[model samples]
Target: MNDKFELPPRRRLPDEIRQRMRTRVWEGLGEPDQRPRWTVTVRGRAPIAVAAAVVVLVAGGVTLLQSVQGGGGQPTAGGQATTTRPSQQLGPLLVPGVAQSAVDKCQAVAFAQTTPGDYAEPDRWRPRFSVSLPGREVAVFDAAGPVFCELTRTTVTVSPAVAAPQVLDVSAPASAARVTSLFQTANHTLAGTVDSQVTGLELGLANADGSNGVLGRAALMDGVFVANLPLSERGAAQGGRLLLSATTPTGTLTGSGPVPDGRVWQGTTVDVWPSGDSDPTSRRNQLDRCLDRALVNGLPGTDAEGWQPGARVGSAADQEGVLVAHRDDGQLVACALADQHGAELQLATRIFAPDRTANPDVPVTAVDLSWRFLTVWGAVGPRVARVELVGENTTATGEVVDGTFAVQLAGVTDAAGWETRNVLRAFDAAGNLLYEGTPVIRR
Candidate 1:
């Protein structure tokens, strides 16, 4: 963050809290992004959710209101630029910068013109940074941040972008995330930025058998990294999945997201293989779209507390998705569910939390939810080694990972008869019986 934008001593928030809020808002903007904006190596920050999103909307609203008033705005036909000088308004110029004539064209495009919606015309926009690449990237920014990205072949403009001083965060040292589509170039490629600590990078596609396939190392310069993608390697199925990774001293950080079409990122395709690798990372990675929704849409008060991604329990075309999310701390366990609407899994319904304890020797609480579907999922005791679903026409084992436990069930079973159709038996490592009971059928 630029320190020029920092609050005056009299108006400043606590340094720590203010930092967290800024991180959350910037990271939260990544609803469609596949990689995390911040790292979880230490796990101090919370994922941005509905609340942080509201902050962004509200900020935009403030800009709208200010713009409507006599506040500063871009130069209209006869209007003059704000008296605020240009140099104070931008970040550093990227190395191998574009020619001044192109920069002059960018300066002509008002900052307000670059962004969509009615925003107060910035005092002025200047070219904080300019990069000459196949993707002509220009940063038209005010101290607030990059106002908008001009990815076109020509342009130059600077705004009050880098006037602020920043407090360096030494604990985590670096943060990374996938760039949004607004700046995507025509060539099939993925783009991201990195700090000096990220010395090397590797990007690849998740394979059919849960192995990794190299897409080629990313090309980095001026804090930006762009990797050419093999278009043939990406498809609508299980094999061609591209994932994100950044290398640091501790270890390599990795992430997955929807496929990039050189235009827009595609939603992950999902499928289940109960008969396959017990559980494949590829299946879980694809189903992550469901888990990602938990960060943005999950509401504990509404019972949709699911977060971590897991293997898809059923077929992808059918559209239903299920994952058991165990909280980082071992106190509670819950299910995250998304239902089939058409060809894909829809935003998950709110009724997700089982809200039960999963301690040693505790009985696993099975709960049945969804009136339209017969879904049986619930808590798994920490010490319990296995949970088997017995009764019905056949016996099936729940996929238990860490403190989570979930199984796929056909909606063909009668909701009224689910309790009698299946019983859950949990056992410890010694195969000693922890407890057994029918599901707590939901309304």
Candidate 2:
């Protein structure tokens, strides 16, 4: 995601509004159209302005519409709607009047909820993202800087407080993003972005039978998407991780992501495979020999000779083992070992990676013992809640064990070019991407 892009705001316009405002946006032609003209141009395509004021909504990187022309007119594709005011560069995002009214009230609520020192000045709060429905079923939602407010014909609502930004992590967001102020919503609508290739969003909510079902969904729209969910507790007290599909492509891509509320649902971490050595004597003998060979190969840490067994990774055959030892700099030196003749062991291959037991980032390392076998392992930190290994021919999720994980893969015959063919990834509980790249290698 680009730093120039902001996070999705709160509230989803009703279905009737969605039906009236569907725009076709061609890929790679999408760019902000903000010029003073009698019309609006989106992605280099022009859309004519209506004779009357039409409601417009903009969030994420796209603009939404309530009406292309005046009330009852069909939606015009490829352009953002605006009030037909001459000499204006563009109309206010969403309906200016409704947005302002909601913002004013929301600001007061936020001010009351926020601690005195944390509150923003009134002028700093601006209506940057918004969406609305026109008529008696009005659902105008505006995210004015730190405050997220929603207005309907009968009631007005906002987030719980002026707090940190939170959203369902269907896709990676910009690093250290600032617009993460309002994620809480008093209404049932959840708003966020999905993978561009994703045509729809399906939420797996908990059922009474301890299973999950698609209780909510959002359709891809020209501007941004909004998910209408069944009304539940604002901060629903629940258990277990909800099924997450941050981005399942239009009949292709599928995956999990972060949830807006950390309480309701998050990534569930499975314990790593334990040191299941059916034969400790044989495993220790091999590990000791591997550590000695590691010393000869310039493995880090002054206590190489005293390095103890940290993990025993089983392989396809008894000839393979992994030697994991701590480096002096809090990193790890994992060496793949093989017995040449059973009297002693030889270091086949090695890797250097973070042993982030105390650090927040997920650690991953990969090494090929034999040209046909590869060993991958890492330590899971507090922030990491999920791990996946992907190759052109390989796909597997990592399980945790005492905060560490190790897995062995057979039939990789391309040691030198393995990284180019495989990818290892780790993610946070909300499906926010943590790491996505090749593991550190020490061949």
Candidate 3:
């Protein structure tokens, strides 16, 4: 009856499957005699049901371990290798924060790409300068006389020390130069001169350190060219002069004098006009508005000082005038005749305001004087502007729009009782646009 009644579902399993299942269940029990003492702990009973559950759990744990540490140990589509380094495997070198490191980087770049003859020799023409660093120096070499020296910095008790020591030029002729100058700031030397047989000149900066910078050769322009360079050490204008002789085709230039009044003219006589009340005294501020030069009084070989007061006055002579025009927006526009100067001339005046039309050609509007600086705006080349406003936050920049300038003047509030002298500007209806002159108040 037992054999014919048909075995239960468990008894009907294949023989190999049934044997394997039985082996798993037996392994889960405490194997007291096994080499490793492998065993499974059940909370309550040691039944076959619990033993089967333990076998399945152990198999799952073994599969997970194989997946992580076997051939599949490499990163998958959604996973990354845990052994990768973060920094060296990614990007640039780790930069140091030391000041010397920063300085070294700057020096490397400068030395690699710097143009030759940027630094001057010992005798370049430049202004005085003060040095405040260590390891600074200046080098000088004399082509003609026996001259070679180096200026070096040292530490003194109270203040820093800088000393000059003479040396010999061991390499070749002192680079044979017709002219040389010492730039004051860098103390470096500049060698070379204009190719002129008639004129020989040399200039030097009084104070320069070796390590500052180098100077370059002079730049010459044809004709009796003149340059009014502002002295870097002092706020003074130095007059650079060049004399052209009939025998010489060109000549060297030198800053020989200072100009108290700002007049550098090509021609002998100039026409000038002053703005505002057009006072004759203002027009003749410096001996008929003449800056000190070869044409001024008491110059060599010229008796311009001996000439009578009215000797050089001619009605047809050029008229240099300073013009002050008014605008509807309470601004003043000042323009100076570049080459004209005289006392008995009429100051040119124009009302520079916006034209009342659909296509308006706006003029520069200047603010009235009220003992304070005001915003003056003018157009530069139809679009850009020159601006002057007084405030800590005032800033001016240029803009181009539709072939006309868009001048933006900001941080200007109230201006009263301030007289702005030599104020040149242009503007549109929106606001003031450009300014060029140095604004000054009259005493």
- For model 1, residues 104-212, the per-residue Cα lDDT tens digits are 4444454333443233333444344443333234433332333333433212223222222222111232374333222233223344355656755555554433233
Off by over 4 Å in 1: 1-291, 296-312, 315-319, 331-360, 364-373, 414-417, 429-432, 441-443
Report lDDT (CA) for all predictions.
0.40, 0.41, 0.25
Task: Please provide, for model 2 over 182-300, each residue's C-alpha lDDT reduced to its tens digit, 9 standing for 90 to 100.
Answer: 33232344444443445444544432222333333443333234444332421233322233333433233332232346333211111111234434245444454344333322222
Q: Give the per-residue lDDT digits (tens) of candidate 3, residues 140-185.
A: 2222221212122110110001212112111212222222222222
Worst 10 residues of 3 by lDDT: 154-163
Residue pairs with clashing backbones, model 2: 165-180, 169-258, 248-253, 249-253, 257-430, 258-430, 271-400, 272-399, 272-400, 272-401
Tell how far residue 380 is off in model 3, in angstroms: 20
RMSD in angstroms between candidate 2 and the native structure over all alpha carbons: 27.2
Best first by TM-score, ranked: 1, 2, 3
Off by over 4 Å in 3: 1-353, 358-364, 367-371, 375-443
